[model samples]
Target chain A: MVRIQDLPRKNFLMPGNAACPGCPETMGLRYVGMALGENAVLVIPASCSSVIQGIYPRSGIGMPILNIVFAAAAAAASGLKAALEIRGLKDAQVVAWAGDGGTGDIGFQALSGAAERNEDIIYICVDNEAYMNTGIQRSSLTPYGAWTTTTWTGKKEHKKDVPLTLIAHRVPYVATASVGFPTDFIDKLRKASKIRGFKYIHLHAPCPVGWRFDPAKTAEVAKLAVQTGLWILYEYENGKFRISPLSRPYRDKSKRKPLVEYIRLQGRFRHLKKSDIAVLEKYVDEMWEFYTKLEEIYK
Target chain B: MEEDHLVLPLSRPAPGAMGKTGTWRNYKPVIDQGKCIKCLLCWLYCPEATIIRHEDNSVSVDYEYCKGCGICANECPVKAIEMVPEVQGGA
Candidate 1:
């Protein structure tokens, strides 16, 4: 069942290694890596992830991580899977753990190639919404009206729907997860790990640095990301789609918290006016409608 | 020899023997034992995994590699951890 309480005790990711304190990416990696267990190998691309794992030998992530270029994590993971299979290590999971820049922007081509081929690799994008490692630059995954080094005035475009794009690739397993909900995140990772063919797990990892929130509120931010419909938790497997437990109540617009409740929590969105909040609210409503229609059509 | 070193699968002479990283930290998290509820929040949120969760759920920082990012102090729900600026030469 992958209980949240059992996660910290598993110890896949060791302490006294490098990673910013209150970094949600590492927290996600710890939970996912523990759920995947000792048999898995991580393929990290150039991002905060590479930094989070530390500088090589002292890497905090307990699993063996194959660090690759910015846009080639999925490709390297595919190659690693082939090598391991040739060596007869078939059941082992080859995880492509990447940041938003790696998965949504620069690495999208290779990621699409892997998903199209249905490569037998478990791909997880731990999105913190910006290029946090190289300074908080705007990536395609950064949400609308959020500040970044490149988008000093706030990103004019909407956040890229990376997982939905993956689902369109018709991969066997596709899902969204949040680190705030450890049980849900663990359950999704465990489910994806057991399934074959290019499984996509999109984790909405919170970044205290880029998100401009108090480090202590990392969990609260992650939870509210779902409660406010800023990030939805759901899974699509074998053509069946289901909303996660914590996000189910939020399926209805009236039930969800106001978008301001989410925006006010982070400093990145502080520049936004009430009209901007209204824009995001409309965007959320459109997203909910889009998801509902997509589910119905697929169902 | 250069190529051999370059081709190494995972290049660390020793895992986590990454030298005294403690010297880099500008601040250190001091646990207020009296106020500590032993909740383990600091241990779980620590990126370095530098904090050790004891059998009794009480936690201790491993000074060997604790880079003092203040995640422990920041995450402690009971406000048990206080981040003190690191002073040179133990002063």
Candidate 2:
């Protein structure tokens, strides 16, 4: 197993890509590519990456990309890997890179099926929390009390607990990472790349445009997301679950920054009332408490 | 490479050049190394990959293609970067 620090220094995402400024998906994709090495095929669905990868007859992704439908990334990747194995190539890797809308909503069926079947694929769900590609429509992953074009007053429903849902299948791997934590993010991707059966990494990417935040604060926002316990960073491997070392400090509860500190930085929650924020805060605390219990049990 | 491919913009990494998006900027980000804690967040989040990381791990921006999006400045955890108005000179 290649050490996380020893991952190759090569740049596979290239420089001229069309991603928006301070795009977290671009950051996640770059690190994932670096850790995954170059001998991999990326199966992307219809999301922001589709546009960022460039217009037809011109592409920016250094490696090959198979752009599947809105809900077929994992299934296509499964088929691709089966075909590769049939051709006597088992060492190659197949990656399904999809946005939260694709993974948690539209493509959840295929992804669930792929994971249940133990397909040898790396499925990365870059969660920016909304359908950013389709003009910032709210998706199941959009956090509660966040304003999208469709949810002008903020979403009334809670964000889907996608990682736990994935873990339910007892897949060989399930992890939560954030663009703000590159080392942990890449480490999980590298570790997932080496494992067999199904692997999934729910990377919390920040969408500046959709979230109505300065394009430059994507990393900062993502960082605060984890520090405030609003986003949990943990991994599930071989029936064991543990919080990531990067987020271990927040286990003290006192070390966690306030949830308000994280939400106020972005404009999406501008319309949210204090009561709504309290609800969100309670939800965050509940999730963190759940993680703490898991950490204790795993330890 | 058939036209019926499922991937969007059915194309592999195309050759040739991309547009010179540098000219689109009205301001540019300037990194102050003294204030820099070497967090590397700016480098990691740079959409254009213009944040060049030296072998020594110090980072510098590639102004040749930067669009003055100020992303690096916004993401720098140490607040070591500043966005400055660009004075264009066509001469």
Full-model lDDT for every candidate: 0.82, 0.83
| TM-score, candidate number 1 | 0.87
> In model 2, which runs have C-alpha deviations exceeding 4 angstroms?
A1-7, A296-299, B1-10, B14-18, B32-41, B55-58, B75-80, B87-91
Using DockQ, give the best candidate's number.
2
Give lDDT tens digits, candidate 2, residues B1-91: 5856665545667421255556666778898989987666677667677787777567898776676678788767788999988875621
lDDT (10s digit) by residue, model 1, range A202-276: 999889889898776787788888999879888999888777677878888888988888899899999998888
TM-score of chain A of 1: 0.97
Candidate that would win on TM-score? 2
Candidate 2 true-interface contact recovery: 0.44
DockQ of predictions, in order shown:
0.31, 0.41
Instruction: Kindly list the interface RMSD, in angstroms, of each predicted candidate in the order they appear.
Output: 3.6, 3.1
TM per candidate, chain B: 0.77, 0.74
> Residue-wise lDDT of candidate 2 within A101-184, one digit each (tens)?
999999999999999999999999999999998899999999898899999888999999898998899899999999887878
Q: CA shift at A205, candidate 2, in angstroms?
A: 0.7
